[model samples]
Target: MTDQPSTDRLSEARAALATAMALHEQGDLEGAEAGYRAVLALEYRATDVLPLLAGLLGRLSRAEDALIAWEQLLAIAPDHAVALHEKGLTLHWLGRTGEAVAALEQACALDPHNAIAIGNLAVVLADAGRNHAAIGQFRRALALQSDNLHLRHQLRRLGAASVPFWHIPMMNDAPRNDAFEAAITAAIAVAGPDARVLDIGAGSGLLSLIAARAGAQHVVACEMEPLIAEMAQQIVAQNGYADRITVHAKPSTDLAVGVELDVPAQILVSEILSSDLLTEKVLDTFEDAHRRLLAPDALVIPRAATAMGCLVASETLADYAFVGEVSGFDLSPFTDFAQQRLPIHGTMTAWQRLSDDHELVRLDLTQAKHDAVLTRLRIPVTASGRAIGIVQWMHIDLWPGVTFDNHPDRYTDGGWLQILHSFPTPVDVIAGETLDIAVGHDRITLILLPLTQ
Candidate 1:
């Protein structure tokens, strides 16, 4: 009968499918792909063939094509887990982060047990800087797969990325904290309780709290790091200053006049100075804040900052600066890879000052604008020795009579450690000869270079 012929045709199709699978197993990808396309052309269980085709496309690095294939597969089987997951990954690779996050979130929702989907979602969230949500997703993934090394590493990195190592000790440092508090109180007294206060880089929310305690009625603080911002909020609440302070979890660059603050602040308090003075992008941050966030006559706390340094020679630090011969190899040519300047605890280390304390760099926080700067200077050498590097420190002019500095001679155990601005190599300079040096900041980094005269 005619029915017999139709049955025979079905049998032939099944046999062709079997041959296609066999070829696929034998590494005949092109032939297998052709066979699969043929089978799909017949509309023979296209859903089942979709995954195989998608995989082949992915293997060929045709992510766009694979994405289209997955979209078609998901249309047929809306709950298709693998299609959803693969589409999410492909989208992520294409830099379509928002959509990729949505798709991956759906995959995880469908299969809560899928650790891979959970981890991918967490990673995407972190990439988007939704760290608080990413932290939760990471925790959920870790709960599912407790021994996952990658997940643990991600969590640790996120946690540590927010707070610098100096924050805790800086918060607990009585002398430094007292000096800043006294200065903040004085600033608030001058500006009055009605002064619109803006605290940039609100680490531990300490300065903002001090401003609040000094009778500031309204204070807006910002911390660039989300984790620190969250912690600062908690700390503010704990100290009962939450009513007076408003913490914005964003960088100062993200702040707007009408949105975050009602108007330009009357007083601006920011402590983002690094040990090397300019490395923390302090100059740029302050300049932006002054130009856009502050009133014309805003009282900028620590109105000025200076980078102080002394030329020095040290045998202990020379080993860290140069690498010439190691294991009897002539790697002296590779000494060019050494760090030009290294941050060291000036009081903790022993190095003679070959030059007096000279101002290497200066930043006026009250300035409304800034331009990238570099200057050439001649440092008079006072001692005779193999000069290793320069020992540097910071002096902050908070307010009149309220100043704080980690002088290399006396201050110890605060957030700031005196930095050893090491030279590239041992340069022998005798007394009465001047060392030519270049100093400046590229808005984000401190540049210190020794020039040959």
Candidate 2:
């Protein structure tokens, strides 16, 4: 009972589709596009033709047209995963990042097992500055497809971009890890097994994990960087410490007594100090934790830190700290704009100590308040040389008996690097003379300058 007109129209539609496919295969994209449009106009198998048409448009660099095709397909089948995924890509191409993320998220949700969809969603999320969420999604996809090199590359890329490069080397530092473990163990031994612990700046969740492994029953940790916090959560879960440790992707100041913690933490373990001490906001972080997050008499790891330094003279370091002339130009004025602080690998660098090590400044972490400190330092010169800067390192008193320092003498491999506090200019001195210099911190950065003549 088929009418001749209907049968003929159907036959014509089939022929048009076959020709369109042949044209597409033969690299005649315009011809293929026309044929595809003609078939769609005939209202024959539009669903099957949509993806092809959209793909061809994309290949032809017609993003707007491709987006329109995907939109039309979505209109027909709202939950179509392919259409949504393609639409997300098109939106991203058009610089509509928000819309792309929304569309890609929808696609990922619809196809939970699709690694491609999940990866694309993660890419868009990262682009939208939702780094934490993006890291989580990428991890989920990577878990499904562990052999995907691209996924691994992206995970490391995001991590490296969001975190400092030294984090990995620091984590790999066995000595540092042992010291922190000993401190955490000591804290737990003193506070007992039921002591509640708070770890601030929980990078890689290592310190928090240490607390958990050390048998702290209840622990709360927080990190301000969303990407780092999210990765920490994964690391904690992977190490099977997720039950004991809860990571808040917020600053320590954002935590509260009864909200983020059931009670004020009884032991506060934090390692947020920079090479110079206060640059990582250690003073602010510890102060805030003491005021709000920690108990009145909470045990603080690394109860004190000392800035240890010795006058150093190096022809090599002088080049890094000062520039006098370049290509016949008196660039001595440029020395005024030289880096006030420079990180140095003391063992690898060519430097001679002009004076023995001395304590430039020290901070008691047990205290809750801090003020700017400035004082005079008298360095007893032993070897006569051009003193370009004061080479400084850290001595952390993690516990009563456990002290650690990255002294330029024996400590060579670790996260800590010797810092050079360059003088306004080089100073000439002889043996048995005292180099009077101003030394201390402005509560944020160390201040070092030789007393000008």
Candidate 3:
């Protein structure tokens, strides 16, 4: 008699599960959920009913309930790939990025051939700001599903968005490229054909290739951006220099002398100088390279760099630097939060010089360490109205005679632009008067402050 009752209960559970599935197909999620729970209460196919209940809860936007259902399913079937993937998606939707990445990564490992899981994992990774890892995952998913348009679009978007826009133009910059190549050849000639060269910030492996072609026996290049580093490796191979050059996806600080390089590098080539000359952490990077990765006297490219600028007054630029009455309302207080630096294409912008070019600051890369600098500069104003700011550019001394500068008057169509370091407030000045200002660097930024006399 007891056996007969157990049989009756099993029949009842099976009927309930059938009814729940019908309700789910009919779009009655609540009814389906109730039926699935009743089936689980009977302990009949709980593993099967748990997934149904969890998916229904997710559809109902009950994420917490859905998570509980998924955890229960996982407890029953620990290796359930689908359950893990769904749980990861839920966690991502709930803004639990770290946990989501962990879960999806696990799912991808369990079901390596599952394209959906891989793509979803890539999405979660990108959300976590792991762009290069995300790109790698996306590429893997795309390789599995070659005709997937969404996957292709994602790769293209990441390539365009994550990288700075100036990289392409910078590569196309013939004059700049020539100057760097000239310096690289000169350094290689001095260091000899067997020189071990280290190129920091190797975008597209251009400089590494230059060193290899210039007869350097070995070249190790490092780029912090993983996506860019991957491309650099590919480009180096495509150009038939893979045997001579190796690119690492890491910052210069992460590279070591014995591991990335066989020994201390004889030449250290880097083009990390920002338009303002210090914003790229050039001083810190170079100092670290010198102390850890380079020989006693490494040949540094662009041995010294200078920040050159002149005082400027422009009605168009004044509007950018300060705000007064806007639409008949006094918004002058907002001027207190004006932009400190504005990048402008010098030839394209209309601005008049109020003073001759002045050397704002200079950085010697060979130095092992640097301290914050502050100096008082007396400027002899020649033509002045309302001085808005200083228009700054770069002058790079590559070797003894080879140099490059993006001067406002001559350098056009290059990747770099003149940076306007705006004053705190517009200062009215007269021609033939001297303006005293503080000009220097805080190791990472060019400090230009107009002083009151």
Candidate 4:
């Protein structure tokens, strides 16, 4: 014979819970919320009833009330995965990114097999700016739910967005690959099969693999991008060069002679030169390698690089470099803020040369140190018009009898593009006249300014 009052209280609580569920299903959120609170006041199934209340509050856009309900549930059931997951999502919606990441991480750990919870954690991690960790979690979630388009899109958005679009075209560039392979082969022949080789900016591990295939016994490679480095490692393993090539996901500056490399490298291979020759900080990287990582007599591929260009006049390019009145309004002041440099595929854009090619700047990579330089250059005009800018290309001296140039005339389908060094304003000149300009480098950028007569 149970106590009549106790049994009556149980029956009332059950009835209240059933009514709350029915109201919630019928879209009466306010009534459902009241009924849930009534059940909680009766001290019945708090762990279960709190979730219903918190979730309803979330739907109602009452984040503060929902947070309070979730916190109350967490206090009673600290290890509850559902409570933690919902709490984390609420915090994220409120822009409490750090706390959201912490809570979601806890939920993920508690429910390791829950792909949705893991993906939620990844979202919070991304908001917290923990990109690498977010990438890891996204990958884990993808492994379980590979067909989920949202997870795949997020992964690609983070992973592929950081990689330059030119990487694929660069890899498929046959002429560039051939030139590098020839240089690597020649270098290995001179240094012998057992020589130590170091590859800087080891993108996709191509250069390191080239050295390995050329019979170099040991090779060390470094890439600063973590995702790219992982791909390079995978590619190296796929090509059976894993034993000979070691890829490190770090910058060249982070490498040490005795730690990453067993001995000083006898051959250094790198192709960090940008289209402008120095924009990639090639001078600084080479100087550091020469000082710390390489042997005094180490042979450096692409021993010298030159910035070559010819004066050009193009109405097409002028439109991109200069601005004037638009819709009866004077926008000429915007011309003063024009871009100093623009990249264009040589074959794709229409432009005419006004003067012959001239050397703008040259970098001797073998040199241990470099200083900024500026010098006056006088270019003889051939067919003169409005000189909008100079169209620039690169000439690389890889090794003896091995050189590569992406001259706008003969090079196409390669990664490099011809740069247009635009003048602030166009200069009109006549044929058979001389155009004098100052040319040099500030260690990272080419300087080409037309001198006022």
TM-score top scorer? 3
Q: For candidate 2, what is the total of clashing residue pairs?
A: 0
lDDT of 1 at 270: 84
Give the TM-scores of the predictions, in the order they appear: 0.77, 0.79, 0.94, 0.91
TM for candidate 2 is 0.79
Q: How many clashes in each candidate?
A: 2, 0, 0, 0
**Lowest-lDDT window of 10 residues in candidate 3?**
1-10
Question: What are the per-residue Cα lDDT tens digits for candidate 3 across 369-401?
Answer: 989999999999999588998999999999999
lDDT of each: 0.84, 0.90, 0.91, 0.92
Candidate 3 vs candidate 4: the TM-score winner is: 3
| Residue runs of model 2 more than 4 Å from their true location after superposition | 1-23, 30-50, 129-131, 143-146, 156-195, 202-218, 223-249, 318-340, 374-386, 422-438, 449-453
Clashing pairs for model 3 are none
Sort by lDDT, top down from the best: 4, 3, 2, 1
For model 2, residues 1-453, the per-residue Cα lDDT tens digits are 233337888999999999999999999999999999998888888789988999999999999999999998888889999899999999999999999999998998889999999999899888988877788889999999999999999988887788887788788889888998999999999999899999988888999998999888888999899878877999999999888999999999889987999999999888888888779888888888888888898999989999999999999989988998899998998889999789988889999999999999999999999888899988899999999989999999999888888898877678888899999899997899999999888888999999964
Q: After superposition, how far is residue 239 of candidate 3 from its true place, in Å?
A: 1.3
Task: Point out the higher-scoring one by TM-score: 1 or 2.
Answer: 2
Candidate 4 displacement at residue 183 in angstroms: 1.2
The true-versus-predicted C-alpha distance at residue 173 of model 1, in Å, is 3.2
Return the clash pairs for model 2, or none: none
Off by over 4 Å in 3: 1-5
Error of 1 at 123 (Å): 2.5
